[model samples]
Each structure stands twice: as structure tokens, then as C-alpha cells.
Target: MRAMVVAAVVIALAAASPVLAETVACHLTYGGETQVIESAPLASPYAGTPTAIGSFFLFRIIFVREPADLARINLYVYAHAEFGEAPTPVQHASYPYPVSNHGRYGFTGLQRVYEPKHESELQYWCEMRGA
Candidate 1:
């Protein structure tokens, strides 16, 4: 029947792309407020973008699950825009894929990133989930 054929095609597609189920989550804290950002595996890192956090920080996470050798997660922390200017990157971190045991990786406790112009500090750390 047509229904059976459609089900078969769906199963075939799922089997061919198991990596679609993977995801990464990053936790960010600044100005006494905490936020979590989650990212799914991407086809291209360049497709990712940073998120605004509070009034002083911007955060971005890139998770890629293809090309086995290049599978990884990348984190970027930046100073949020001031006076309509672009956000400024303040820190970056990278982690390899297959993060075992839902592993927690990032700063020991909390780390600091300083905004270049005013030397203001931002705190952050991240963990991988559903990896």
C-alpha cells in the first residue's frame, strides 16, 4: 500500500542520519542571572549566531556532528553591542564530540571574560547534554 511505502522511506531516512538526535547545551551566568542555550548539530559552523544575554554579554554555541574527524562544539562569548555597534568577542572554547557521560566541560567553577573597552567582567561555563 502507499502508506507502507511511506513508512519504509521514513525509516530509511532516519537510519541514514542518526546524528540528527545529538545536541549541546551551554550554561552562561552574568550579572547575577543565569541562562542556558541549547544547540543541535549543524551542517556548517558558519550558520550559528550569538545570543544576547542580559545587558552586557553575548553568547554563541556551535555543535557539529558530521565529518567524524571534525565533530565538535564551539563556544563564543562576547560583549553585547553598545551605541548600535556590533558585539565584540571576548572568549572562545572548543570541545570534541561524543562527550562521554553527558560530561560537564567548561570553566572550573566560574571564569571571567572582560569587555575590552570598559574592562567590565562577565562570568560563564558550559556543559554538553544529549550528546
Candidate 2:
């Protein structure tokens, strides 16, 4: 039936959508002079305690507006920080950025975000406003 076909199409769209949640808790940490981001807004940012989630699929940083000011940022997991830097964003808008899974240690939903060059990693990102 036409109705059945429509239902299938809807289901397909949902599957294609990126899975996510609201308010992703990004743990920012830095102490050494190079720790705090050097730019406008605020100075000297540090890490916060990890947040707990019962269960979910995956978590990523959905920037309301990507942080183009960030010189470097580190994703915390397994007591290790992966260093990353943003290279002058050509444009500014909301975009989804993926957070790699670190086995048992990972957060779900959109938590953190920073500017990326030419948005080469966009495919891995999800929708910021909603999952």
C-alpha cells in the first residue's frame, strides 16, 4: 500500500539521522601555561569532573557555534588527552563533531565542539540542535 511505502521511507530517514543527546559534558583540563586557551571571551579553562550516563549509543560535541577561537583542545578518556587544534574556520555556524569511542570510557550525546578547517570531518558529526 502507499501508506506502507511511506512508513518505510520514514523509517529509513530516521536510521540515516545521527544518534545524539542534549548537553554533552566536555571535560576540559590544562594546568601548564599552554593549558588555557589564549583568546577572547574567557581565559584559563580547566577540566571538570566526568559525568555519568546510564546508557546510550554515542556522544559527540555539538557546537551551538563552533569554537573557532580554540588553539588546541584535548578530549579526555582513559586518563589520556588527545591533542587537537583548530585551523582558522572559513565560516561559522552550528555543526556536529564526533567524539571517538574509548571502549568503556565515553560520554553520550553532544558535549563538546571546536572549529575545524574546511569541515573535512563533517561526515562523522551529528546534528547540533537535536539528535
Candidate 3:
């Protein structure tokens, strides 16, 4: 049936595409420095929620440039992990002077054990400019 064929095609296309999460505007700050990076809608997936690793939370971040931009730019990404009412810095990572203007870049911070026996939170930010 025509309806069946259309459904099959839709399923095939969905399977071929990569799963993407919402893109959020973030302010990255580190060592008395701060910057904001605007990401394109439908851009490649960069970061995800921290995963539980035993008694610790593993933080991660991925950065990808928009395909429309041909200019090479350096991107600096920072991730902060915290627990309890007061956030305590647990990890810091960055990608400096990327060779390519396009593609995926990633960083994984050192695992930090959960404190106060509760789930931790993650904050992300980045700065980008011409190399």
C-alpha cells in the first residue's frame, strides 16, 4: 500500500539521521575570563548530560562548527561540575587553535565523585574567534 511505503521511507530516513539535542546559548568563563558562543540551530551535537560513573559523574563536551562558515576559528570550551547548594569546580578543559573550521571537537573532564551524596550539575560555555 502507498501508506505503508511512505511509512517505511520515513523510518529509513530517521534511522539514517543522527540524533540531536537542543542547542543552548552558553557563557564560558575561566580564570577570570569569560566569553559567549552562539551556536547554529540544528547544529551538530556538542555536549550531553553527565553520565553516572560509579560514585562519580563523568563530564563531557563536544564542539562542532557550522558547515556554512569557512573561516577557521579557535574555540575555547569550559565545563564546570558542581554539587550541593554551593558549586565547586571539578573539571576544566579546552580546545585551542583547531586546524579545521568544520568537524566535531570533544573534551572529557576528569571524573569527580558525587559529594553530599547527590547528583551533580554541569555548566558549559565557550569562546570562538579567527585563528
Top TM-score: which candidate number?
1
Q: lDDT by residue for model 3 over 22-80, one digit each (tens)?
A: 33234433333434444433335443443332233333344444564532222322233
Higher-scoring candidate on TM-score, 2 or 3: 3
How many steric overlaps does candidate 3 have? 0
For residue 35, model 3's alpha carbon misses the true position, in angstroms, by 32
lDDT of 2 by residue, 46-90 (tens): 433322111111112223323545422233222212247322322
Tens-digit lDDT track of model 1 for 66-97: 88999888888888777989777788877787
> What ranking emerges by lDDT with the best candidate at the front?
1, 3, 2
Listed in order, each prediction's TM-score against the native is 0.70, 0.23, 0.27
Overall local distance difference test of candidate 3: 0.39
The TM-score that candidate 3 achieves is 0.27
Best by lDDT: 1
User: TM-score of the candidate numbered 2?
Assistant: 0.23
Point out where model 3 deviates above 4 Å: 1-47, 67-88, 97-131
Error of 3 at 27 (Å): 27
